[model samples]
Target: MKTPKFLLPVGLACATVLSLLSAFNMPSWANFKDAPKEIIDEVWQVVNREYVDPTFNNQNWQETRRKYLAKDYKSREDAYKSTREMLKGLGDPYTRFMDPKQYESMKVETSGDYQGVGIQLGLDEKTHELTVVSPIEDTPAFTAGVKPKDVLLSIDGRSTKGMDIDQAVNFIRGQAGTSVALKFRREGKPLTLSLVRTRIELKPVKYSLRTEGDRRVGYIRLSQFNAYAAKDMGNAVAKLTREQADGFILDLRSNPGGLLYASADIARLWLSEGTIVSTVDRDGQRESITVSRPAMTSKPLVVLVDGASASASEILGGALQDHHRAVLVGTRTYGKGLVQSVHSLSDGSGVAVTIAHYQTPSGRDINKKGIDPDIKVELTKEMAKNLKADQVATLADPQYARAVDVLGQQIAGMPVEQVVAAAGKPFPAERQPVAAENQTPVATP
Candidate 1:
């Protein structure tokens, strides 16, 4: 793996506005109280000052604030509803309003303890259908044979058609002893599964040393890019390299994404020296992040991605592909180049404002256009649903098998270099049809 640097950029106009963001960026569950009008104003002010799209989706930002503030909000619920209405005008699903429960749920999933059926959900911007981003390992959803990209049809007899991310999560989560029924479609067949809710622990990284032919392959399945992902990944790489793994396969199949900085740290593990990724603001100014440290391993590498892979997954995958540090396998990624900076307001409710958009090292804007893998191995619905966790990175998994074959070729012809080559002609810049419309991680479980 090479050591690459990653960064998220935020445009700050002045110290006054910067301090305003700092004060409002408290923990989602923090105890805070304010009038409904005050809370509404705070959210509007933040979006106006820092939203990545200075044009505010071609609408008047000042008029938007005045319109929302003019309405009389009797309670926080009223304010939240109005806030969501304001965000919708931006035409960006990534920048949305999160009630206290939803924000706290997101916080627990990405950084703290959480409870649920062990599933992360996403919304398709085009269809407005709730889909499975991933099922956290060792959770009820995973055990019930839930797979990524399954189009959610209903939850507890309620249809998910036209449902946004927030509504789906609120329906799925409940008390630990409660059971929830989820109906989704896979390969044109409908299936319903009932799962008992429970406390879910966020275990981000799962690794194994697999024997393929005569080569030892280090298999690392990053379920999500949470707080613990990078550290766990480092440990996995170190231990596997110690065991003399000939190559490594980093699997980011269904990961929806988590923390931004966590993705940065994980990219550095495989990049030695090069500009990993860059962030561009609305004004066309750019900030590029580069690292010159030695890579953890110069061994051959491959990354597996699918339609459910979004956000931080795209960031890490893009960097590796740009540096040619790892060959990408599987299908095109979910496009989510926009970066959202989430902040909890005084009333515990939170706002995720699109602060900037990222570009691949080759200056590819993968917003509506996702990154195409170097080796495309189409994953059929049957194949995605039939493979068990244990079978991944083994012969039974078609994508992993293809990754191994590609890794084997690299191993046979690669040299033993301590540092990866500098960026020359990166992997062919290709874009594919966008799969999921929105892939925001809005819940913990």
Candidate 2:
């Protein structure tokens, strides 16, 4: 999920009012041959006066409105499509108007599953390179040897360069049994791979119990907050408790986040009965999302984050940090405070529009300003090379080490103050951006 944009509060309120007034009050024909003339007049007046660019197309609003209304296109939906075209005339990609159907599709995107290729991708804003974060297990990508850290070059024959993240995703996914070829690079070696598409059932949450030295740690890596995230997390916690796990390390690094409800649901597993997050709409109507006491997870916890952590990730991290439920350690999170609504269209297309802003439990706005770690620890390239070069026991990632250290503080009965004091200083390093490819495989599904 991407960070939402926040327009001026006053501007949003005014726009909401205008949208409601324009969309409501339709032509009610009791037994007439056509829609009443009042409807056309209403649309014409609103379009002529409220449209940002009234000098648009150099065409008369009343004439255009009449042309549309005379064809039995006088419903609220018709007016909305017409208004959308007006906004599209502005040539702004971010500025969009989503109808009810498109909005519902977006909601389904957040909460439902569909058949498609299975790879999680991340785009470098500066380089415009798309990196493969991870492949969904048992899916085509995973089956075809796609791995994390591989840079995606193209999909089918289309280059991903200049393509938006969502646009790229749409190209990669399709109906089951359909094939897409991808060109990618790994460690400077160019390669082409083709795989048959299939339904991807992403288990966003993964957990394991391990014995590190003398301590027992429960590790859970959350990639995204899918609908069943909370259930998976609860099961992990229960398993750990049964196994007498001494501490917990919740890894959320590079997690782009998902389902706002899923994030709150996961947080409820740790937080007591209270507000989890607050959403304030354009009208200042505040909706407080709270957790029940029965859902709280009572264990020593440490949550990990990095630049890729955003949206729902920030929500969970912020909630845990505010309640002191977990000690966050790693780079600052990806700041994204906006909430979006995805509306579907009649023609099967959809639009995602920013609607509101969200705040952490402590009332902090993390949009564009990510959450700072309580104990900041930067992962250096040297550490990455060391782990890749060494035959260390289970993966010795630097961020993981820091998380274990934080969790150890409580498990070893050490004072939180001492643990905080033991945190190492930051070490900044430059890492090369991942590369992209051009040609796709000849054989694709």
Candidate 3:
């Protein structure tokens, strides 16, 4: 059978429609109204053939199709509802059916620019509460003091109990200059914030240089792994290198991740030749993505991660850690190693289905088991508040401070064992230093 023409590249965590039909080319309402059964059958067939989990999460796929198809879907809305119910039976959060509106929103989000209160939201599996994944820096939500892991209680006075991610996003998004009231709970305390929506153009990469005596440490914070991330990061590294930066700190805190290719491209900046990541399909077929580009920098490196770091963030961090190129510091990262590909349907809707599971360069699976920091640093309530208020200096943030310290020691030619001992963290058996000869030479741009 010929594959669908709308198949696109894989995205991590969030749903991002890759290939889409133009609005003008979408099927008319009358067509949808007459072909509800056909639409429902298409959805079922796609999931049955392409879902990553062959067992269907132990749910009978044919039974689900039969149960949903038994009812007569007289309208497009009815077919949409039935399709969603069918997907929900798969028990995978990343695999979901998107209606036309939701599919449009996904496209806008993947484009790296949009109008909304800038924030990425996720649903908490345990509590079933809508949680703030991360606030886009300098946007309305970020400026309004929205922090990661904040549980959303309500939106504009309507409770978010049992609300899905798309529904919550719709409630929070509005026209530029409009306002949305958000009630949320942070650290077990209730709080409210009002934010004005705006045209959010994400500058995914931000950098600043910190001085420690005669040495300058280049600090780069990657907010997400969007399409422009690699280019922006390259510019930052080049500028910092020209400024005589001797060490580097990569902050991946609260980064929920984006495109897989973007993450691999960023990894190539530090690694000259090595496995960046590997993906395993349902049939045990494994494909490795290796770094093809030359190294941008050979400076001593430290990576900062937190509970909110996931997907592509984990991929980059894990590759660096496995290659012994950088030491990870901070709390355990959010583990999300599943790969999803979004397919555009004939009716302008879409379905993001999990296609495979990815592994780090060292062959470690980080799905439910998150990557542990080489040196763990937990944030205190006071420090969290200070960070939100922009009152804390870079050195005052525990994780970041630790990363800088480690990077400084590495620049001074400290041994890995000594660095671990100094940080008061146990040295793992796998923690070995990469020999100088094994380190790839930095390539000139």
lDDT (tens digit, per residue) of candidate 1 on 218-291: 99989887778889999999999999999999999888877766777788888776666677777776766565
**Candidate 3, which segments miss by more than 4 Å at Cα?**
1-34, 391-393, 415-418, 421-445
lDDT leader: 3
Candidate 2, 111: how far from true, in Å? 5.4
Query: What is the TM-score (0 to 1) of candidate 3?
Result: 0.88
Give per-candidate clash totals.
8, 11, 0
Worst 10 residues of 1 by lDDT: 9-18
Write model 2 residue lDDT over 169-199, tens digit each, in one string.
7677777888889999988998899888776
Sorted by lDDT (best first), the order is 3, 1, 2
lDDT of 1: 0.74
- Residue 141 alpha-carbon offset, candidate 2, angstroms: 4.2
Residues 122-172, model 3: lDDT tens digits: 877667789998998889898888889999999999999866677677778
